[model samples]
Target chain A: MASRSPLLAALMRLPPPAPVLMAGSHLLTRLGRKMAGRHPGMIARLGPEAGKRLLLDATDLPALILLQAEPLSLRLFPRRAAAPPSDAQITGNLAAFLAMLHGESDGDALFFSGELSISGDTSAVLALRNALDDAEIDLAAEFAALFRAPETVVRRLAVVAGPRLGLSLTRMEALP
Target chain B: MMELVCPAGTPAALRTAVEAGAHAVYCGFADETNARNFPGLNFSRAEMAEGVAHAHARGAKVLVAINTFPRAGDADLWHRAIDDAAGAGADAVILADMGLLDYARRAQPQLRRHLSVQAAASNADAINFYAREFGVKRVVLPRVLTVAEIDEINREITVETEAFVFGGLCVMAEGRCSLSSWTTGLSPNMNGVCSPASHVSYETTPEGQDARLGGVLIHRTPAGGPAPYPTICKGAFTSPDGAGGRQTGHIFEDPVSLDATFLIPMLQKAGVRALKIEGRQRSRAYVAQVVRTFRAAVEAADRGAEMPVGALAKLTEGQASTTGSYAKIWR
Candidate 1:
């Protein structure tokens, strides 16, 4: 193989990656575990079958392995799994995922514009989307509640989260 | 000034719409009584009571949509829906099924009734019939009529007219189609569903990614592409050209959402009482954006000034929007 170009070498010679990405992923995994423990009904939305897997690849973040059984489970993975551990995989960035979950924008529109992609068991993915739309999941509210946020600050956190997450302030008010 | 009536699939969406300047917000309880009856959407009875109080506190009215037609053996469900809507303090209940409308007339005479767009009551005579029989105070006109047609109907009908000025459009006659049922054995009128999630499937093939509705091919997009949901009317198909050859394309409608924000003036001049936005199945963000934009537009219209519609281009279906029957090209 030819030696790397000087420009390519320069591009590769960037600063070391941040320690926060790994730390954030660990924190989120813990939160996911807690949420899973509390909301078994949400996992049932996947399907009736046991051992159904959903691989969620949030582009800028760590991939998540979700097992959709009677008790749904989630874990963050450092790299792509060697085996296909999912019937379906939904790939999107945080904004796209937030838009999808919050109904902040049209999922079809997002998918059409290539902001989101679904591979494998389309029906299962559709079921998940419909389920999410039917229900409300406010991250800021859950966070606020978990932290025992002051009532005044909870509303403030929700208002700040609305535009950033493409959610309505009204909807965010109900989060806590 | 014309009122802005918006759809709220959930209580959060309802509150968001009201806060964002919706004069009225319509929602359904978490059941089959409403047309936008999708999973994880709509409200429970407690949620409804809270939502109504919230809207009323904001000086906004709440319209409960019991618009889905009552099934033969399930009349009691819709009957109870109307009763519950009234009990929950909804300003009015939007009804479609004639039998249910009649039920509301007799059972809750004090509660106001609006004929739902699901009734597809386009003509003055049809609208007048409902007004005379069920004492309907308003009619949520279908997306099929032009502004001129609406103006004519307004001149003849005694009840107020509500027109959908924004969001999704059904190309078929509202409340009268069986296309979804023919494919899925369920429909909005019968099962309170259309192109329901259970019947939709997608697959990746050598050709591309194909979406199917009830096992029939609807649309095919390239691999790793954006495949629009296989909503029947917005799906693509290949059919005979009448001359023997075949043609493949979107036969009914290109996947486009309706955006009549520019036509607010004409609709108001046509004597439309309320401007409705469709998307009860949307998020509170979407509701707030649309409501906020329309509120500005309606306020601008009151001042006889043109208001530019802002960044809603991203919220439309397929990134394309249409006026959809308002200008009457179909006529």
Candidate 2:
């Protein structure tokens, strides 16, 4: 294979069985290996409080997660008990999970529909809700750097579908 | 003596109120033109005219409410409501929206206009702005002001002031809330409905019975417990504490109604022109009981008699009532 890019080299250096990325129904495991050589700080802003509060107040939460999907891959586990080789895994389906975060889908309804099943603290899920409302995620800048990448098809699909689906689903869910 | 304006949702309620010695009675068209757009309530235009005739013959005034905001591109309905109220010989028409106020002032300069509580004019500056701009003769202050604040406002304003003595309490500032719209796509300002019944759903599970509005779980009561309607702000929610624990309960307000009956004397002394009772969705019997009780209280106040003990407790929502932002210390 051609010499891996510097970004990929840095990502590979991180301890991993590696994270997975799930886009809508499409699932990709161990995808973060591609960016092994990249500086973590280039994207990960330091400090837990800053990160926590930023996520708590984000308005465009689904958009942020959708953009992140293009550059990072995460593993999907059936339950919290399932052994994961890496500690940095992020997992969830794009369409339904994003819908719930936007307040378009109710937790009870999605749980009943078997559309949402999470192994994490539900409070952490709510924290994500608050964070999305609190965070100021700039999709333009974040996506600009990754727009031309070969893997951006899923990200582009999410960009087009997330808001429209969220809005329509909210209306559907609102109706008696 | 300050006028005691009581609610009259039906013709029987109108007669009950007039008989019980209300100084004035306020009702609305049997349509969306009014704020209390509850089903099977309010009066028809003919009913209103007859009710006015009855109240007038009894030496009491009648005010018509055309208080809800007019929809975008559909101002004609509200204009017609104003004209109808004027044609029916209402003593005054209570209004809220600025555009509607201007239209009424231009269309029927001879008719008196009372500012509706939905305007949420809690301060003298806003009250003066309305009075100077629309020639508003009186203002029904929002439920958010304390007696001291009301006194301070009366000291500055030229128009007459009305304050709520009893009924439903709105915790949020009126005419400016969107929490209802965010949940149900309907709003008090736009649809004359808050926490509309159509969007509410209840579900029973092994854990509890969940009350939902627009599909969001707002409250979960024990299986056989009474389920309060899920009004967004009053709903139970979990909030995180600084030390990594959860605080679960009503972070805003508990489910309680407002009853400021004991403050009548203080309100009158504060230069109030009227004390308003706030339930057009209420039954005629409820109206009669409340009107009779308040009439006695107001008469006693006028004659310098001691205020009566509580008699309207059963009429309150949740079987519990509050003075609601009136004490200021509650804040």
Error of 2 at B153 (Å): 1.3
lDDT of each: 0.75, 0.64
Predicted candidate 1 versus true structure: per-residue lDDT over B1-331, tens digit per residue: 7899998876767877888999999998767888876656677788899999999998999999888987787698889888999999999999888899889989999999999888889999999999998899999998888888999999998899998877877888988878788888888776678887667766657876777778887888776554555788888899898999998888888878888888888888989989899888766667878889989999988888996664587777767788888886743
Best by TM-score: 1
Where does candidate 1 clash, by residue pair? A134-B39, A134-B40, A134-B41, A135-B40
- Tell me, what's the RMSD of every candidate? 5.9, 21.4
lDDT (tens digit, per residue) of candidate 1 on A72-161? 445455444353467877777655776566556656567767677776665566556655554466555455555667645766766765
Tell me each candidate's TM-score.
0.83, 0.62
What's model 1's interface RMSD, roughly to a tenth of an angstrom?
3.7
Best candidate (score: DockQ): 1
lDDT of 2 by residue, B187-211 (tens): 7776777766456655546775566
Lowest lDDT sum, 10 consecutive residues, model 2 chain B, at B221-230
